[model samples]
Target chain A: MSVFIIRRLLQSVLVLVVMSMLVFAGVYAVGNPIDILISPDATQADRDATIRAMGLDRPMWLQYAYFVKNALAADLGKSFAFNVPAIELILERMPATLELASCAMLMAVVIGLPLGLYAGLKPKSFAGKTIMTLSIFGFSLPTFWIGLMLIMIFAVFLGVLPSNGRGATALLLGIPVSFLTWDGLRHLALPAFTLALLNIALIIRLVRSGTQEALLMDYVKFARAKGLSDARIIGVHVLKNIMIPIVTVIALQFGSVIAFAVVTETIFAWPGMGKLLIDSINVLDRPVIVAYLLIIVTLFIFINLLVDIAYSLLDPRVRLGESDS
Target chain B: MSQQPALSTATPVLQVSGLETHFAARNGIVKPVNGVSFSVSRGKIMGLVGESGSGKSMTGYSIMGLIDAPGKVVGGSILLDGREVRGLDAESLRALRGNRIAMIFQDPMMTLNPVLRIDTQMVEAIQAHEDVGRHAALDRCRAALAQVGIASPDQRLKSYPHQFSGGMRQRVAIAIAILLKPDVIIADEPTTALDVTIQGQILAEMQKLCRESGTALIWITHDLSVIAGLADQVCVMYAGRIVERGSVDDVLDSTAHPYTLGLLNSVPSRNPRGQRLRQIPGMTPSLLNLAPGCPFRERCAHATRECLEDPLLEPVLGHPTDAASAAHQVSCHHPLQTGIST
Candidate 1:
């Protein structure tokens, strides 16, 4: 197990190196951000000084090397827009996105698991069909559109909740959380639920199919033959077996949830990494773009690593066999 | 046959009469187990022999009440200890299962949950039916595993299902079935997947366990040799119905039904070397829309006009049909008087 963890950690480092190269090159491939950063009336001398200061005059390879070395030292350079360290700015905004993403994830799992189980177990039942039908809207409807619809209904028409922003946050573990207060919960509900809708739907579909297949497995039939009650059989026997895939999907989706939060963040004007990303992109901030993407890529890789670890823990065959079964 | 203690005095451990199970398909309802009836006395093994799709496994499922959606026991009575088990509520049925009766599937992997350790699964199997502490249940699990001839049960209990070899996995499954010393055990081709040597060992061990513990067993398999070697009584199924049943010696030496003869002839072991092995002619009739006739009529060599009509399970040989010698009943219009009537 220790060997597996060590091997995965090594793989994650390699993945980050390769990914950093792609992000560095990809960011540079876009037009220079200096055009937007400087005034149109600026003199050539002024532009040259800005270029020299920003190391734009340096060869692309050398600049990339500098970026990698700085990233390795936990210094992602200064953002062209904010004029502050990119890493520091990202760290500042990380908590809000993390809190929101985690909450959305919590909501997805809390609601989706039982719903999926019931639908899968009784796909032909009335409630099962109804849940499945409703879940389609969660999948097909646009997240921003859903966010707008929810705000219009609860915030605009009913006035039951605030229309936008993270409201009334209290510092918990140095992370400002909105869900601590009822008013904050009301404000957090709309966008968080909107972001969660797609995840919940996707998770529901994944779990439903997985559960349906697992329920048909010979082991389940054997469990039934052994006389385990419906509760124990479904809970202990079926649930654990099917959780392996669901956990993998959910973990991988976490990165996407943060990335996809762009539209939701903009629509709700929530102060998060998504909003920060948009602000950086508008001014063509090179350092911020690279750092944001690198962070997301790192997050994605780490999540995948955790999933591999969870896989081995969940199914012994995965740990024992060469192929991940 | 010789070793079985006089078991007739006690009520048979399992009894199924008119067991009919239907599976709903797109085309029509498939009658997999139609009017199937059999009983296994304490300390006896009844071999349910059939080809693929013969409803042998379905019969086992019906007795265990394991039939689920798309398939149901429409009309039947599964009697465990002389109590009608067909209409028992799920809770009561669950109480009877893994306690009064248990099942071993064709795949050991099927019987053992992959995520759970053997000890966890076995202990839970016991605890599911009875209120017992973990250590006490573990002791019973080890005892059961040892009884099934597994070595170092203590260490094996900690291992997961994947840790064990195919044969060893099957032994663990067999151990689970005998965990509670269930009055009856329905093993659906438990040894079908194992090699001959492992199969032989398991068969011998199982026969001995039945003798020692007085557990009635229904061993379902398509292999005739397995039946001949392990079972005291044999029921040969063609298509959702038993065509022949008798004592092991009587049935193997001189079977009454033509399908049974066909089954015996098709075995490669019975054929001479360098010659193509005999196979029964024609396919099994589709149960969904079977013609109004015997299920085996399409494949029977001696099929006559009388065979076009459904043949009641009757005594065609010296053994009276459904009589005390249920061991010798043959549901055939024309029984083999002198030899396999081909």
Candidate 2:
């Protein structure tokens, strides 16, 4: 088991390095560093110096090698436009998006699983029909439209909650994380629900289908014949069998949740990486963009690794040294 | 033998009467089982023989209350110990299923959970209907495993279902069913998938166990040879209804229903090892779009114009065929008489 984890972690490292290099190459191909430095109005001498200092005059391989070295050392350098450390800017905005995505994923699992199980176990019953209809509505509605509707109901009409921001204008517990929107979860009723509601619908349907299929497996019939109650049969036998695929879908959705936070943060005016990324993109902040892309890629690869370990744990039929069943 | 009250001397442990189960489909609702009746006494084994889709498996499922959507018991009763069991609720039905009447399926994998260790599954099955401590349950599970010819019970119990071979898995399933000493066991082709040697061993084990414990068993299969060896009584079914039934000897020997005779003649038995097996002439009738007449009339060579009326089962031709065949019954308007007919 330890060897399997070690092997998986090593593969994850290889995956991240390959992804980072690709991103670096793609970003470099778009435009030159000299464009930022020698704005058409700059003097000839300043342009020459900026080009030399940024190493734009060097061969592409040398430039990329230098970029990789500085990148590995966490010296994301100053953003071309923001004139601030690239790492610091990205970190500043990451918390808000993380908080939103976390909340949304949590809500999805909590609400979706039971709804899915109920739908699968009792197809065509009253509760089943109600859940199915709601799920359909949840899936069909656009994410942004739902977000807007929530803002209207909770912010504009009800007036019981704040429209946006991390929290109260002041810091709590004497610690300023600078990601006010994350602290704003105390007032996150609308944004979190908007982010989660659609995902919950998607997950519930997936879980319900997986559960229904698992329930039909011969082993489940075996468990029932042993006289286990319907609840026990579903909870233990069905859940364990279906969890591997469900975990995979949930992990894949985790990436989307992060991406969705971008639009959500912008709408709510929350200080998360999505908002930060968008703000940087509008002004064309290079270092910060590079840092954010690299971070997201690395995080996705890392979570995928975690999912692999989770799969091995859930099903003993898979092992590093043996053939899979 | 003295004249004795048949009910007192030979009360059946399970009596299924007029049990009709129908399944509704887009085409229409078709009765898969129509007015089938039979019984098994204490320690006796009854084989229900039929072709696929002839409702033999459905009968077993009905007895176990495992029938789900699209199908339902439309008529008749299932009585265990003279108590009606047709309409018991979920909780009571579950209580009775694995406790008093257990079923072993054809696929051994359907009787063992892949993820769990054999010991965990076995012990849980035992304690599901009993209030026993873990240790006692485990001990009984071990004994049950040993009883079914699984060597070194302790070692085998810790292994998962995947670790065991197909025959071994079937033995484990049979062992769990026997552990309860259920009043009636419905084995739906439990040994059909096994090799001949393994099948013989399992059948012998089941016969010994049931005989010793006085547990009635209903062995459902399409194989007549299997019934010939294991069952004390046999019911021959065609298109979801009992075509002939009697003691195994009377039914297998003093043949009545043409379908039963066709089944017996079709098999290349040891008695006629070199002879060409006689094949039945036509396919089984479709459950849907069934003709308004006898379902087997198309395939029965002896079918007559009277067969188109859907004949009711009674004393075939009103003839007292055999003194020993009083209990024997055939559902045909014209049953073949004894040696003179053959």
Candidate 3:
């Protein structure tokens, strides 16, 4: 098992090496950040000095080598907009995004899994049919559109919650979170729901299919025939089997949940990395774009490793198989 | 035998009478188990033999109350030890399942959860019905494994289903069924997927276990050869109905139903080399398109006008044995008789 993880970590390092090249070349290839960084009225000398200071005057290969070296030391150069290390800026906002994405994930699993399981259990029941029909909107409709509608219903008209922004923040376990207070939670509800809607839809579909397939399996029928209670059959037998796939789907999509939070963050005025990315994109902020790409890509690889670990843990066959290999 | 019928000494461990399980398909209702009836006495193995789609497995499922949506035991009295199981509520039925009545499916993979360890799954099966502690359950689990001829029960229990060979996994499944010494076990072609030698071993182990525990066994299968040496009694099924039933020797030697005769003739036994195996003429009649009369008349060698009407199960006259073996019965308008030529 340790060997498998070490192999995975080494593989991740290899992937990052390839990714560093793409990030350096790709960010430099796009629209110039210098256009937004300095005034148009500035003299050629002033521009030259700024370019030299930022090390843009160096050959592309030399600059890429420097970027790789600094990146290895956990130092992404200063953001063109914020004038702080791009990674520091990312790390500062990381907590908010994590809080929001995880909450949305929590809501997705809590809400979607049960509904899907129930739907699967009684495919012919009216409630099952109703849930299946309603969940389509969770996937088909746009996130920005859903966010506006939620704000309109819960905040503008019903006057029960805040419409935008992450509410008053407090530290929990040394990490600042927006959901500690009632006001914060109220503010969180709509954006999280918006971000969670598609994920909820995806999870529901995944669980429903998983459950339906599991129900037909010989083990399930055998369990039922053995006179296991409906609760135990569904809860222990069915749930345990279905979880491997659901966990895989969730882990594979966690990075996307963070990546796709852009629209949800913008509409709700939530301060997360997604919103930061958009601001950086608009100004053609080179360092911030480069940092975001590298972080998200690295995160993807790490999450895949976690998924493998979780999978083997859930089913010992994988764990034992890994040892043999 | 703990839950054996209190009212009568004659009460069999499982008494399925006029069992009818139907499925509502697009065309119409498909009768998967059409009026199937049989019984297994304590310490006896009753083989339920039929080809695929003959509703053999459906009969087992119906008895276990495991049939789900679109399929239901529409009419039947499945008396497990004289207790009516047909219309029992889910909770009541659940208590009886895995406790007094257990089932083993054809695919051991189907019977065993892939993700669960053998010990965890087996113990859970017991604790689902009984309030036994984990330690007690584990002890019982080890004993059950040892009973099924698995060595190193302790280590095997720690292993997952995938770790065991197909034959060994099935042994674990059988062990689970017998863990609580259930009154009846409905085995649905449990050895069909196994190799010949493994099948023989499992059959021998299963029969021995039933004899030792006085647990009635209903082994559902498509192979007459598998049942030949294992089952004490046999119930031959056709189109969801039991066509011929009797002591295994009596049925095998003096088979009355043409369907049974056709099934036996088709077996690839010591037939002459280069000769085609004799087969029944037609496919199994579609349940939806079935006519009013005999299901096998189309394939039977001797079909008469009398066969157009459904035949009631009649006592077979010539068992030529002890009075107990004379309980043989066949459902046919023209059962092979003393004077009648095929």
Candidate 4:
């Protein structure tokens, strides 16, 4: 298992290197950041000095080499927009995004698992069919639109929930977390629900299909014959088998939720990495963009590794080795 | 073993009569187990022999009340130790199952949850019906595993089903079934997927367990040789109906129903070497929209005009009907004469 983890770590490093090169080249292709860095009416000499100072005057390869050299020392250059280390800027926004994504995932599993299991177990019952039909709406509705609807209903009409921003935070282990405060949770509700909509739908479908298939397995019938209560059978036998796929999908979805929650975050004005990424992109903040992309690549690699470990944990047939027994 | 009183004098552990299980398909209501009846006494093993789609497995499932939706036990009287179990409420049925009655399925690989440890599966089976403490349950599970001929029960119990060989997995399943020491166990071809040597060992273990504990076993299989050796009574099923039933020796030696004869003839060892193996002609008739007659008439070589009417189970000529245990019954328009060799 240690060897497997070590190999995965090495692969993650390779991916981050490739991603760094790609991000640098891709940001370079976009209109120059120097124009936005300095005033529009600045003199040519002023422009030249700023460009040289920022190391933008060098050839793209040399610039990438310097970026890589600094990156190896945990130094992602300063964001042009924020005037702070790009990594530091992203890390500052990380907690909000992580909290929101975690809440969304929690909601997805809490709500989707039972509904999906019911739908799969019955499939033809009226309640089961109704749950499935509602899940379709969760999938089809756009996140931004859902975010707006939730805001209008809870904020505008009901006047119960805060529409935008992280309302309040309490220091938990020296990290500001909104969920600890009622006002902060109220602020979190709209954006988190919007972000969770698609994932809930996906989990419902995955678990439903998985449960339906599992119900037909001889083991399930044997369990029934063993006089196990329906709750025990579904909870233990069915849930364990379906968890392999659910864990993989949910982990990957959680990564995407953190990375691509831009629309919902923007709509709700939630200060997260997604908002930082969007703002950085608009200003052509090359360092921030590169840092963000590399972090996301690393997250995906880490999540994939976690999924493999989870797979082995869930399925006894899967062993963490080159050759499976 | 000391001889006990005749099986007929004492109440059988399980008596199933007119058990009909039907499925609602798009086409029609398919009767898989159409009016089957049999009884097994304590410590006796009754073999239910049939080909694929012959409703043998369905009968076992129906007995366990394990039939799923779109299929149900439409009609039946299942008496477990003289208590009617058929049509019992869900809770009551569940209480009886894995407690007073248990089942072992055909494929051991598929019967056990692959993710669960052997101990977890066995412990849960016992705890499901009883309020036993975990330690007591674990002890029972360990003993059950050892009873099924598994070595080092402590180590084996910690492993998952995948860690064991196919034969060993089946033994685990058997161990779970016998954990509660249920009065009756319906083994649905539990040894069918195993090698001959493993099959033989399992059969011996099951027989020994039954003799020692007085558990009535309903061993369902299509292999006549398995029935010939392991079963005291045999019921040959044809197209959802029992075509022949009697003492195993009587049924194998003087097979009455032509379908039973055909099954015996089709055994590769029974046929002459280098000759085309004898096969019963025609396919099994579909249960959906079946004609009102003997289900095996289409395949029976002796099918005649009188066969158009369904045949009722009746005693074979010269068989002693005085003792129900010794009665040799066949459901056929014309049962083959006694002492007729295939």
Q: Measured against the native two-chain assembly using Cα atoms, what DockQ does each of the candidate structures obtain, in the order listed?
A: 0.76, 0.45, 0.79, 0.89
Task: Give the number of the best model, judged by lDDT.
Answer: 4
Candidate 4 residues lying further than 4 Å off, grouped into runs, are: B1-9, B318-326
lDDT of 3 by residue, B245-312 (tens): 99888788888888888888788783456898778888999998578889999888778998999998
TM-score of chain B of 1: 0.94
| Shift in Å, residue B173, candidate 2 | 1.7
A159-208 per-residue lDDT for model 2 (tens digits):
77776877743454554333364445555667777788888898889888
How far off is residue B291 in model 3, in Å? 1.4
In terms of docking quality, model 2 is: acceptable
| Candidate 4 chain A, run of 10 with poorest lDDT | A316-325
Show model 2 residue runs off by greater than 4 Å. A32-42, A74-78, A81-85, A168-183, B1-9, B268-277, B289-292, B315-324, B338-342
10 residues in a row with least lDDT, candidate 2 chain A: A174-183
| Model 3 TM-score, 2 decimals | 0.95
- TM-scores, all candidates, are 0.95, 0.90, 0.95, 0.97
Top candidate (TM-score): 4
Q: Mind giving the per-residue lDDT tens digits that candidate 1 earns over B180-266? A: 888899899999889999999999999999999998989999999899889988988878998888778768777888888888889
**True lDDT of residue B335, candidate 4:** 87
Candidate 3 at residue B76, lDDT? 72
Residues A183-213, model 4: lDDT tens digits: 9998998899889889999999999999999
